[model samples]
Target: MIEIDSRAFGNKIKNIRNSKHFSLRQVSNQSKDETGVAISPSYWSLVERGKRNIPKPQTLKRIAKGLRVDESDVFRMAGLEAPTEATNLTRITSSEMVSVPIIGEIACGEPITAIENVSGHMLLPNNLVKGGDYFILKCIGKSMEPTIMNDSNVLVRAQPDVENGQIAAVLLDDDTTATLKRIKKTKNSVILMPDNPDFEPIVLNEDKPGRIIGVVKMEMKMF
Candidate 1:
């Protein structure tokens, strides 16, 4: 196991938090907005001070996004080296960004799915999202092709609710599923429609059950 110095990690967290001019409350609030996950300000303060150890990977991703830096950058700040940048044919803006780790791929109604171990990630704007939590995923299949494509990396802002017409990471039943489809509201149901016509739409009884995990705030095409 790679041993990380707790004190050094804390100092690095503090440095990044201060550098971004974000207070403990600000960080907690941003996290709540972005991830729909509640993080106490006092607890966050301890985490920043390195008084807290063993931060979850998802939490790390969120903190990196909130601080406008990459997870590798955060690792480096904590005395670990940053990972090499992934190559993509698509044009990337010169502005700094951080890569959120790809947990896996998800589908709306497929019986089978692809659940890969932490294979790769998608890059996103450092400050565009407010939540201190996020993760990336490579979209597969044509169910949401064209706009999302078969191999596009999508940056998901982890939250429970999503706005209309935005791509989202969604969960159906008990599966860890994700879709690059747009959200639309009907009088009786919520429809998850695809950009392409080859696939059908997913209709949910809004007043009853269903999960719209989060919105896809950013994407990078690789094909």
Candidate 2:
């Protein structure tokens, strides 16, 4: 097994994060908002400063996306030449922080308010969850299965809008309901799609009415 010095790995990640002109919080936010994974600014700071080593493959993928590089790059920076070495872990803190649950989005059949009532859930270990601003949500159906599995935990942010091709939590004109779906906006209308093939598409006439909450940050599953 290849030994990865935590400090060296942290330094490389820090260098890339800085070169990208992105703050630790900023990257953490994006990971939660776009990919449905969560990370904190403080932990990211430590990871970049060579004070920590990452062990999860999913997390590496999120960091890779956040950094706009291939997944292998994260390993290379961490001083690992193989995927197996990436699993060797280390920590910066003894006590782990908590990440709350977020459960709302486009194509989601549940009421938005229903998901909000859940209390602050301290799940992922400090080493795994990474410290940051994040919330978790429950997935109801299989429309997003294979992409987002049923009974999965999704992380989300609170924002008023999103760009094209991003998954969002949308509120239809029906005041009592909400849906979680991927959105594509055109000049005439908004296209709402379900990740699964069994479902049909929903078109929102821009001239009519609709609301967009934040984008989907992360999707997690518990075995």
Candidate 3:
């Protein structure tokens, strides 16, 4: 079995949280809401600061869920093998399947779509996502946690627009980065809402430069 250094593991967790812009309190709250586990902000802070040792398997699982990250990654960071469910989901038979391109990361700060972003491909079971053109993107932030999840691979169907309250991948004014958020349209503006309360809603004027790249059809958890 691989051995994980305690301090290194702690740093890893902290980095993941920072990348998602999730505060310790937010992670704790979301974990409790999603998994019925109560992890206090103080305790999580200790773990992140390397003052406390890594928790047990069950506790680690709760932390992973709370952070909207792969539980298996957490397990590995702690020098443990991932659970069967986490390890087995990606193994699919070739029959009745289609290859979906797994694009590079989509930034929440700005939105962009281009051919240079292609990273690799994933074979997905057919009937999972039905649409005109479909691709996959690795979610990079906690803004949509408890719904889309950070680091989760989301299946997107190419479309210019989506109904209100629907989640979509969008490009901001610069169109150099991309973000995934729930669309809320008003008379004068469009609001991108994050499922995590810690994040403030992004309001864009109706006339602002932006476009919906695609609607999220499905999510494939990565561990």
Candidate 4:
């Protein structure tokens, strides 16, 4: 991570908050991480006054959402490197945007990104997303709220599996059901854990089975 002027970052945040007419408590209460921890009002004040430390990526995202701004723009202000730029492209406002297919229902036996599976396409100006074959897959449930919203289409990088603690697009019931959840692997089983505590984790074993088709690179533009 790059060291940045805390005051400069704080000023940028304060100005945004003021522009939105949001108080410290309002932003703090409106913001929360995926784990459901909100930034405290006291800490928020300290941040605005340049007396506290910079927030993590997740915290910045929540705060930006509370401020009704793009989190990538906040990241740029803080001099933090995240996949906030370029990928935020909705319709390629710039000169370059690669068209990625939007995969609908699973064809089961057919190729993952086959034409039979594509329902639509999304244009994006992203070198990161261009690094691999990508498709848009909708997260069908509320399991990943505060990170990936319910029924939100996510940009997916085509891959067979992912490391532990990474969110993946997984197919269940022989590819008839599609869902998004964080994956955890053990010697005996594959565990699909939900970010929300309101939902229960799914443990797949001999009786229950699933196949990971891809990992979510980012949330696609909601349009």
Cα lDDT of candidate 1 equals 0.64
Q: Write the per-residue lDDT of candidate 2 for residues 1-223, one digit (tens) a residue.
A: 3577878777777788789886676576555524355677777777776666565666676677556576778867655564553464545353564555544442344444345444445455554455334556566776664456566666656567888877776677754345668888788888888876798878888565777755676665443
- Count clashing residue pairs per candidate: 4, 25, 6, 0
TM-score of each: 0.46, 0.47, 0.56, 0.64
User: Which digits, one per residue and each the tens of the lDDT, describe model 1 over residues 43-101?
Assistant: 77788667888476656655665565667776655554544455313465757676666
Candidate 1 residue runs with Cα over 4 Å from true position:
1-99, 105-117, 120-125, 128-131, 206-209, 221-223
| Reference-based lDDT, each prediction | 0.64, 0.64, 0.78, 0.79
Supply candidate 2's per-residue lDDT for 170.
67
Q: Among all windows of ten consecutive residues in candidate 3, which has the lowest summed lDDT?
A: 106-115
TM-score of 2: 0.47
Better structure of 2 and 3 per TM-score:
3
Candidate 2 regions off by >4 Å?
1-96, 102-116, 124-133, 173-176, 206-208
Cα error, candidate 2, residue 109 (Å)? 17
Off by over 4 Å in 4: 1-62, 66-95
lDDT ranking from best candidate downward: 4, 3, 1, 2
- Clashing pairs for model 4 are none
lDDT of 2 at 41: 73
Candidate 3 per-residue lDDT over residues 114-213, each given as its tens digit: 4566677777677775557788877889999766668777878989999999999887766656789999998988899998789999887756667888
Which lDDT tens digits does candidate 4 get at residues 1-223?
5678888889999999998777776677457543447778888788888896787777778778667687778788778876655664355455576788898887877777888888988877767476678889877777786567677788889899899999998888877677899999999999999977799999988999888889987776567
**Selected candidate, larger lDDT, 1 vs 2:** 1
